[model samples]
Target: MTLAVLLLVSSALPAQAASNRAKQRKLTDTQTLFTKAMRWGEFEQAWSVVDPKARESRGLTGLELSRYKQVEVTGYSEIGSMSEPDDIVVRVIEMRVVNRNTMAERTLRVRERWRWDEADGQWWLQDGLPDLWQGQ
Candidate 1:
């Protein structure tokens, strides 16, 4: 019985690790998308990653993202995250941005709630509006 219990515990560890790795990947993907879009001055593309549900709830239009001009992301750090089943994850992402023209830089700490869509098999940032570049 002891041997059987040990085997079960070992098996569960690998599965749990796999689950954690998957969550890490999804969070990384979110930061990657944001970094790539902002670095290239592609605000529209960045908007594409915003949660559609959030857009509707917040009454935000895609045009709102146009407010940003040239931006370069210098740092991205995941400060917090929460896991709820396989479909709900919330993360606080901290980033440093530099204006391409002014060369001025500031750090924006944003709490981004992410939800995993089973159909899409991916994650979406729930806040939609990151409140980025405020007073920067």
Candidate 2:
């Protein structure tokens, strides 16, 4: 009985590890796509990467998108990331933004919160959107 149990447990480990690797790959791909969208000023396209719950609650608006048009993302880089409980990943992103009208530039750090949605089999950004004009 002991040997049989051990055999079953050992057989499951590799499958579990493969699943983890796949999830990690998906996360990396999603992050890359999101970063590119932001850098290129594709706010609408970027919105698709946000969590559905966030979208439903915050709801992207025309005024909000207009604000993005007022500024251009000059640079975007991920400073660091950490994994949290409940399959959550938090990342610190540094962005160099320039005001289109004034041509003034500013560096801002934004914290991005991502959570793994089991039903969807993917990760989602819990934070609705980056408020680039928050204190401007």
Candidate 3:
């Protein structure tokens, strides 16, 4: 019984590690895609990457997105991330934007919540950008 239990446990370890690795890979891929779209000023592409539910409710008229659309993003940096329940991760991103009419340069800190959607078999942005126009 002892040997049988040990064998079973040993076999399960590799399976568990593989599952974790897979999840990590998916997260990395999602992050890369998000970073690329955001840094390039592809707001629509970024919107496409957001979770369907969030996108539906927070469409073009959403405060978060509307605020972003009002400015021209020059650059961005991924500063921090925190894991959340339900396979979600919140990321703190800093963006450099130039005012559309005034051309004033400012740095904005935005928070994006990302969630892994099992049904879709990938990660999705759960929340829209925070008040990126603050302190501007």
Best by lDDT: 2
User: 30, model 1: CA deviation in Å?
Assistant: 4.3
Per-residue lDDT tens digits for candidate 2, residues 1-136, read 9999999999999999999999989899988988999999998888998999999999999988999988899999999999999999999999999999999999999999989998999889899779897665
Give the Å shift of residue 67 in candidate 3. 6.6
Q: State how far residue 118 of model 1 sits from its true place (Å).
A: 1.6
TM-score of each: 0.62, 0.96, 0.82
lDDT of 3 by residue, 1-136 (tens): 9999999999999999998789879988887887787767677777777788876886766665666677777877889989988888888888888877788998978888888887878888877544555754
Which consecutive 10 residues in model 2 have the weakest lDDT in total?
127-136
Using TM-score as the yardstick, the better of models 1 and 2 is 2
Q: Give the TM-score (vs. native) of candidate 2.
A: 0.96
Model 1 lDDT per residue over 41-130, tens place: 677777677778766677545456545655676776878878777567777778788877889989988777777776776678776656
Reference-based lDDT, residue 121, model 1: 60
